[model samples]
Every structure is written in structure tokens, then in C-alpha cells.
Target chain A: MVNTRNMVADNYTPESVAEAVRKYDGVRRKQAIGSLVRSLHIDNIDVVASYGEDAAVIQNGRTALLLAADGIWNKLMEVDPYWAGYCAILVNVHDIAAMGGRPVAMVDVLSASDDAIMTEVSRGMHDAAVAFDVPVVGGHLHPDAPYNVIDVSILGVAELENIIYSSKAQPNDAIIAAIDLKGRIHPSAPMNWDSVTMKTSDVLRSQISVMKDLGERHLLTAGKDISNPGVIGTLGMLIESSGVGAVVDLTAIPRPDLDALGITFEQWVRMYPGMGFIMTANRSDVETVCKKFRKTGMAAQVIGTVTSTKKFTLVKGEQETVLFNFCEEGITNI
Target chain B: MVNTRNMVADNYTPESVAEAVRKYDGVRRKQAIGSLVRSLHIDNIDVVASYGEDAAVIQNGRTALLLAADGIWNKLMEVDPYWAGYCAILVNVHDIAAMGGRPVAMVDVLSASDDAIMTEVSRGMHDAAVAFDVPVVGGHLHPDAPYNVIDVSILGVAELENIIYSSKAQPNDAIIAAIDLKGRIHPSAPMNWDSVTMKTSDVLRSQISVMKDLGERHLLTAGKDISNPGVIGTLGMLIESSGVGAVVDLTAIPRPDLDALGITFEQWVRMYPGMGFIMTANRSDVETVCKKFRKTGMAAQVIGTVTSTKKFTLVKGEQETVLFNFCEEGITNI
Candidate 1:
């Protein structure tokens, strides 16, 4: 009796997990984003960075203005309008923070056919706005509509010299991921890992400020928040955007107890963690950056190392599998 | 015999026309906007101005960051997705320009049920982005949806000291309206005045730059773009926001052959002009400001004067009618 449950259960190879994540809908949907970006790209005088970054950086004198927008998924809107609305703001704030900026304000565009749905959405938006301390300024509202939709855009600010970008990762940098793993999967949505809602406002705010600190200190080379795509997929995106590659160790990826949560390793690697980020930093600064995130009550660990091969790979025990080959296939191709 | 036809049919009794415009659906729909604003207002660290203005302003160091989001009407989306997408970007750009800011970049959230609508909408967005030289960066896309909707948000930058706000008009200030009347009604939507698509990019760019000039010179006290609620309703919103009032001489409003367009005097005030702005300026600077707009190929005229009575009145030959009273009833109450 050689601890059969532990060995057999955790013995799943990396190739199987890699293939599933590569073919996941969350990752596949991103394939068309690049073409759409190319079609709409134009020369703008004030736009310092656009399609390739988390938020488009606009040069406004000595300050860099961050602008980004996110929409709630239709399925989420149908199941629960409140969560959808909360996530709309949640994702946008993450976008700004991922770029090492402080979110200042937000505007929303909401369309709803039902009054009950509208009220719930508003309630969620209000709760999130208050928690984040970012005002919901002005927006267009469609009161009577056949479908429900919520789109939110945020504006943030950072010093021009201190702003971090997604295209500056260097080879041999340590890849670190900081995630708040103190929450469980949402009862309504299996893929959603609820973390922020249950925490105090101070805790959430502290977690958001860690990125800004890293930006100011120039501790991180490149970064992105974990979104609909899970941890591994998000790292793939960061690597692709930086025109570099990464090799992530499966065991080092921070995760809650999958067995207790009734989820598998593969599913855990493909689910969106509500409050999580993937970042790259120099080996010398890794300890300082991770310590900053740890102070905010998040688990930070070195999950991988940036590489020059232009390919994303996953390793589990002695098995290794390629998730994406940027030379031929890209995540967003931004 | 009464010379009704020769006496300028467009210059009808202001009382009757005012009543018709007050009851129009375009204006009536705006009545709900105020309640929504009151519900959403929150305290933020950097938000300087929000609801009731064309764009929300946020303090970003020495600069003011402008953020705004707009959604196309459901009817317009059903009529033509292409025009709907085009208008989405067009209106957001106007929101920034109306605030005397330089537009930086935009992001859009598109919900479509099929590829045909998506293609058309994307094409329209592409055309406008290229024409205006504003890039549509990254945004959310709903590939399979129950309905079609397009919402766009923009980022802009303005000098903190020179930003034009909608709530600063003083009593006795001249109210000026500048509009491009050289356009036809859109074939898909009769209420839309399609001036931008017909003009060359050079002409539109110059027209947009006029607002910047006005801000830099401190020529205007308050300003806003004429949107779906049309010229008068937009003016009503501005006055309500400023907590002031105005009296308009209906005969002074610029119109392009109401007879040729087969529209009534009331209908003209409710039609959405493609390129138009309402500004409140000191009586002394009115002439110079109007001259600047006229040089940019726009028709500019003094149509009213700001008042302290907190009422918007439309006046004609020996007849007058009240449009809105900010003290008792508000348009957007922001």
C-alpha cells in the first residue's frame, strides 16, 4: 500500500493538461483579437501604447493615462446579473493595476430588459465601486432592451517614467505569481474563484496597491492579471506579449486544495482566479517583490523562469509539454 | 390674407414649438437620467467631474484625464450595425472634444448574434478610426449573443487649469451654438444628421480643434455637444448641471431649410445634429468665439443668454414658453 491515492491521483501527465488548456474556450477566443486589433490600429498622436498592453497608455504630459474596458460574459449575465456587474469593474481595475497604475475613475454602459436584473447589477456595481474607492462617474443607459449587457471602462494614472509594460521581460527573469487563495469556487459559477468579495475593503485595497508599489520601485519587468484564462494561460499571454517564452513548474503554481474544492489539477489550472497576477522580475528582486505581495495576504511563489525560446512549456515531475509555440502560434499576437 | 408661408414657416410661434419639443420622445427619455445619476454618484480620490457632462474628468497630476462611455440606441442598432458602430466612436470622440480635451484612444464592447453584424460593425469602426486617426485598442467581444449592441469609451487629456466644464456658466453669459449644416439626413435613420462622413478628414479635424482653442483662450464658461436629445435638450442638461438657466431666442437657431427637409420647427430642435456644440461664453467674447467657429466652416450664432432665474425659456416674436426649470425640475441633476 504505497499511498495509492496520492500517487495515482496526482500522477496525471503535463501533456494532457497542456492540451486541454490550449484548446480551452477561454484561450481559443483570444485568437481573433489580434486580427481585430490590426484592422482598427491607426496612428494617434497621444496614444503611447494601445493593442499590445493591458490598458492603452496615453501620454498626458508627465503622467501616463491608462484606459481600458471590459464586458461581462453573456452566460454570466443570464445566470447572475449581480456577479456579472461586479466582475465588469473587477476586471477593468485589474487591467489598470496590471500595468502598475492607480485606478482613478470608471464609467459604465448598461442595457437591461428587466428591472430586477438592473437593480441587482446596480447593487453589485455600487458595492464594488465603494470597495475599490473608484467612482462610477457617467455613462449611457439603455433601460428597455431585449438583452442584458454591462460594459465598463476605467481611467488610471502613473508616472511616465515609473509605468511598467507587458513588453519588457528579459531572458532568465524569474516568473512569479501572486494569488489570494483563501476563497472557494463560487456556488453559482464553477469557473469563478471568489476571493475579494469575502475580504475586507482594506485587505482588497492593499492587494491592489502591491502592483503599484512594484511599478514605482521598478521591481517587475512585465505583468498581467489573471483573467478568464487561468494561471498557465495568463502566463502564456504575458510571455507572448513580451516576445519571450516561459517554463512553468506545475507543482510551484500556487493553488488551493483541489481535492477539498472537488476540482482536479487540470481544472484548477484552467479556472480564473479572481485576485491573481503573473509577473516577471529579475532574480535579485524576486524576494523583495514576493515579500511585498505576501504582506498583502497573498501567496507569492516563483512558478517559472522567462526564456528566449519563444515557447511556453509546462513541467510536472519528469514530464514536460509545450503549451504554445510563439514562433507559429500566439495567444493574442498583440 | 395671412402670409403664413412667406413669413418663414421655420420661425413659428415659440410657445407652440416649445411645447412640441418638450413632449418629444428624444427629450422625454432624458428625464430618467437624473435619477440614475443620483443613485450612482460616489466619492473618489481623483474624480473632479462626472454625470451631466459630455465626459467625466479625473485629476491626473497636472493634467485632467477625461473618460466617457456611450451606447447606441437599440433602434439604431437594429436599423444598421455599421452606422451604429460608426456613431459609437463618433459620439465618444465628441464627448472629449466637447470638454476641450485631446482624445487619446478608445475601446469598444461589441455584442453580436452573428458574424454578418460583427463584420459590418467592425468595418464601420475601422472606417471611423482611420478617418479620425483614433485607434480602437483592446476590448471584449461577445461572439454569440442574443442581440447586437455596441458601446465605446474614450480617454482624453486636457490641461488641469484650462478644462471647460458644464457647470460653470454665469448669468448674462451669451449662449452660442455652432453647427455644421452642410449634410443630409442619414438614409438608415432620418433623425440623424450625417455631416461627418460627408466631410473630408481635414475639415472634421479642424472643426474638432476649435474646442481646444476655445479652452486655451478661456473663451467659454460651459460647453457640451448636441447629442440624441438634440440641441435644446442638450442645453437643458448643461443648464441643469450648472444650476443656472437660460433664455433662448428661437428665431436665432440655425436650421438648414426645414421646408426642404420636410420637418417642423419643433422637429428641428429635436433632431440630432452630426456636428454641433452648445457653449456659454461671456458676452464680450461671444463675437470672437463665434468668429473662430465660423472660420472652421461652422455656422455660429448667439441663440440665448444665461440667466439666474433657473428657468429655460424659448422666445419668439411677442411669445415665450418655458422649457425647463432647474429649481423645480432637472434634466440630469448632475
Candidate 2:
């Protein structure tokens, strides 16, 4: 969520780690969401949920229609149009999958000042769409805009009973962290861990559908895809929406060789891996849920426990520190 | 359609009106569509239709889920932030409505460099969403992006049998034009006709549902909402998509007082009226379709005839002009 820190307490004090996460740009940017949602009115009775979930769920009898949109950050686009396009589709597909839905189709809105960038972006989008087996059906394009931006929206279908809502966490539920640990940081964007790109379509599809399986089995109480705000910040948003918090064990978070990768614990927690999830499950169901993710070749472990205290705390060895006090300041404040 | 003139052969040459519509920026900008769509592949069995419709129709059980995305022009965003925001929602709603579906919800991806523009844009979107009764359920925001962009995606639903298609216009069908004439040119953008802003939500809702009613009654062979390409260019796209031709009488087009508004007949014909539609219907059902629109306080007329030939022609008095020959060059070749 912030600056990298070594394992030693002397090198990374709990208070300092807490302060750095509080001041990170990823967490700070989410503050605008509260005002944006406040300005919108929910006049549609069919809209079952909005704003706080990864994707908005609309009622269609027993079928739930999932809709979500994601835009590439300008910096990300400037760094690599190909990755930007890939992430555009990736994030949108994740939004639907996070809701335990199978993505149907995607529509993109792209604006580019030049053809070279637009071609690269479209190529990236095409390759990712094919890899995920999701079609880019249709979209609008601004061929001569002054800047480059790619925004993608996906439609997914699921049963209403099977939705894995971010607001359904129970106080006693165990928080689980699942992430693919076999990828290197993207050469262009250091914050991204590129795990899906090298994987086959069959493997990637199975990995994504694990959430749906978990939902169908009702193993997880709540779940969310890890995004730009990273695991900790994403968890903050999820538990905040659930009106709860947690005490996380930093040492228990699933990780690769951090020292070998040359990324500190703080940065590792903040990195947006190509495939990752933060989920909550009942204590007895925790092993099965983790096993489901582990079967997809992802490392899944119990990282913490949901709490009624309305605060997020991190524990390492004998030291513990409060990361986010939901009762005071919250990420996304929704 | 172009300048109004006497029905005499010497009054208006076919080449002149053809030049006017062909030279329009709206029509010219759409030329990029063919290339963009060619780069995308649809592997999903559920996608019944895609690029050639107002909204891409996806099959699900007995229902049809409609998904469409639209991006506001940067020029519009720069000229009027609120209008751009409003149009973002307004246009997305129309895409669903044009496809004879009831819009359920919407998601937006917005990037604003400053607070004031963002606030105004959100206000515009909120007001439009409220008027249309569609919720802005969820979206992604780039709070600190370097540029301004507003892209919106909408979800709509309809019975599979009742979905209207842009690519289904039949030869010998009566081409109908419907538009609310009770509006002035928007103060900020000259090409926009401000119609919906002054109307009640009830009135606006009825105006939008006329197409739905038409669908239920099986009154239209094909349909498309009048967009930035104005009545003529939109019709060209519709006819091109349908693989048919059309002969539109210049005199029959619905319009406000061009002279009083101080805009020429040419200008009015190219304006994007806030509430307008171009539809092809059975010759016998044309009256019923027009009557439905007239009942909603919009002018409705049988302005054209669909033909087997792949050409669009305009007529006034004894003069006839070919607007577009789809067999050669076309607008949005998709």
C-alpha cells in the first residue's frame, strides 16, 4: 500500500508502516468515490446493489446481470499501451468474476491521438480478450483525441443466490488471501505482477472461475479482486462496505521470495498481481476455500480474522499496529 | 437532406446535397469504425448481434440483454462540461431505447483533471440519469488524470422476440422520422438541439418508450436513434447496416423553424435533436407508428422509402440527389 519495508521491526516500525499506507496515492485517490456516489440517485428498483461492490448487480428474475467499467490510468497508458489495453479488459473481467459471475461480453471506449498507440492498445485488448475467452463485442472510438485512454465495460450473468457480495462478511469469518506467486513485476509498470500473460487460456479460465465455484458452493462470505489499491486497501474497502474490520497477520499473507524479487513487504502488499483475491470465509470452511484457490495454482492462506472492532490492524511477531480505523478515516469512505 | 428548395429540377442539384452530407464531420469521423470492428472477434455464443446495432444484443434464456458504450467528444467536454456529462448518460440511454429495450442501469469511467469540471460533469450525469430513471450504479474514476474524458456504458433488457435491430430494415418499408421540435439550439453547442432538458421526466419517459411500444406492436422493420450524424447520416448507417437503400424526401423531414432560429435548412438537418429517431416500418404500420410519436408531442412523418438498391437518395420537387451508395463508400462500414 506504500513504501517498501524490511522484515526487521527496527527497519520498519509499525507506526511508520501505518503512516505510509495512510498517505499512499492509491488510497488517497479513492476519497473522490464517496462524493461521486452521493451525487447519483438509485431510481431503478431492479438495481440490487451499487457503488460498493466490484460490479453492480441488477435483478432479472433469478438471473443477475453484472455491469462494471474500468479505465486505464494515464500513467499506465503512457508507460505501455499494450499493458494498458490488457489491463483494461483484465480489470473489467475481474469485476464480474469478483461478483462470482461469468463474463459475457465487453465494450470499450478508446481515444487516441495516433494510430500506432491505438493499434497497440487494440492488439493488447484483442490478445487478452482471446486469452480470457471473453469477446470485445462493440465500443465507441475517438480516433483523433489529444490523449490516449481506454475504458472497458463488461456484462456478466449469474444467479442472484450465488453472488459473492463484498458487504456480506461476518464478524467471525476468516480473511483469506489468494494470489499467483509465479510472475515477475511488469517491466513497464513496476506495480503490476504479470502472471496471466504467460499462462494458457485453459489455465487462466479455470483460475478465474474458481470464485464462481466458491460462490456456487457458498464457501466464502465475501470476496473482492485485488486492484490498484492493492490487497490491504482493497480489504479496507471490502470490510468497510461490510461494516466491519479485521486484524491481519502480515507474516501470514501469501508471498513469493520477496527478498529475491527485491520488493519490500509494504510494496508486495500493494502490488496488483495479475490474479489475486481477498476473501472472507467461515472458520470451518476456510480450508476448503483456500484449497479451491490452491487447485488453480494460486497460493491461498488465511491472513487474518474479520472483527467487529471497525479497525484494520496488522500483526508481525510480537508487534501489532492499526492500519486503518474504519470508524475514523476509511479508504473510499463508502 | 439538405437545403429546402422548390420541387423543380433547377432548384436544388443532387450533387450539392450529396456533397453537404458527405462532407459532414459526423459522417467522416465514422469512417474509422470499420477498421476498429475488424480487429475484434466474437467467440461468444450469446452475442446475437454486435457492431451494427445501437446496443449489442446478447441472448439469455427468453430474455435479451443489451450492452452499449458511448464516449463524449472532448470538444463537447471542453465546450460545456455539464452538457457533455448529461449527453454521456443521455446517449447511452438512447442506445438501449433505440434497440427497443428498457434500460436498467449504467456505469461510467470518468477522468477529470480538476474538481470543478468533475463536479459539473457528475451533476450533468446525475440529472440525466434521474430524468431517464436509470441509475448510475457503479463506475471507475481517475481523480488525478491529466485529461478529461467521460465514457458511459448501459445495460438494458427486453424480450428476445421484441428486440428491434438496426440491421433488419426491409426493402419496400416506409422509413419514418420522429423528432421533438419543441426545442432551441443549445447555447453552448450549435449542433445540439435542447429538447429533453425542458421536459418533465414523465414526458421524456413516454417519448423514449414509443420505440418499445412500436416493438411490442411489431410496427417497425428496423430502427436507429438519430445521433451526431443527424437524420440523414444516421439513416445512412441504418440502411447500410440493413444492406438496403433509401429514398428520403427532403421536404418531409421534421424540423423546427429554421429561419426563425437563424439556422439554415442545411444546419437544422444536421443538428442532433435531443429526442429523435429514424425507423423503417411496414407501409401499412407507418401511420400507427407516426401516430404514437405524434401522441408524445413529437413530429412524425413518412419521410423516405427503403429500397433493395444499396443507395441513399434525397428528393425535393423534381430534383433527386444520391447521399450515399453503400456498395461503394459508406458511413461506419460495420
| TM agreement with the true structure for every prediction | 0.94, 0.96
Per-residue CA lDDT of model 2 for A1-334, tens digit only, reads: 4344534322554566566667778778999988888887666778899899999999999899999999988999999999999999999999999999999999999999998998889989999999999999888989889999999999999999999999999898999999999888999998898988889998889989999999898999999999988888889889999999898888787887776677776777778888999999999999999888888899999999999999999887789999988888878877
Over 4 Å off, model 1: A1-4, A7-11, B1-16
Tens-digit lDDT track of model 2 for B55-138: 999999889999999999898999999999999999999999999999999999999999999999999999999898999999
Task: Give the per-residue lDDT of model 1 (tens digit) for B7-90.
Answer: 445557777777777787777766666666766678766778888778988876677888899999989999998898889988
In order, the interface RMSDs are 1.4, 0.9
Model 1 Cα RMSD, Å? 2.6
- Local distance difference test scores for all models: 0.86, 0.89
lDDT of 2: 0.89
Model 1 residue A59 CA deviation in Å:
2.3
lDDT of 1 by residue, A13-101 (tens): 78988987988888887776776677677777777787767888878777787888888888888888888888888998999999999
Error of 1 at A62 (Å): 3.3
TM-score of the candidate numbered 2? 0.96
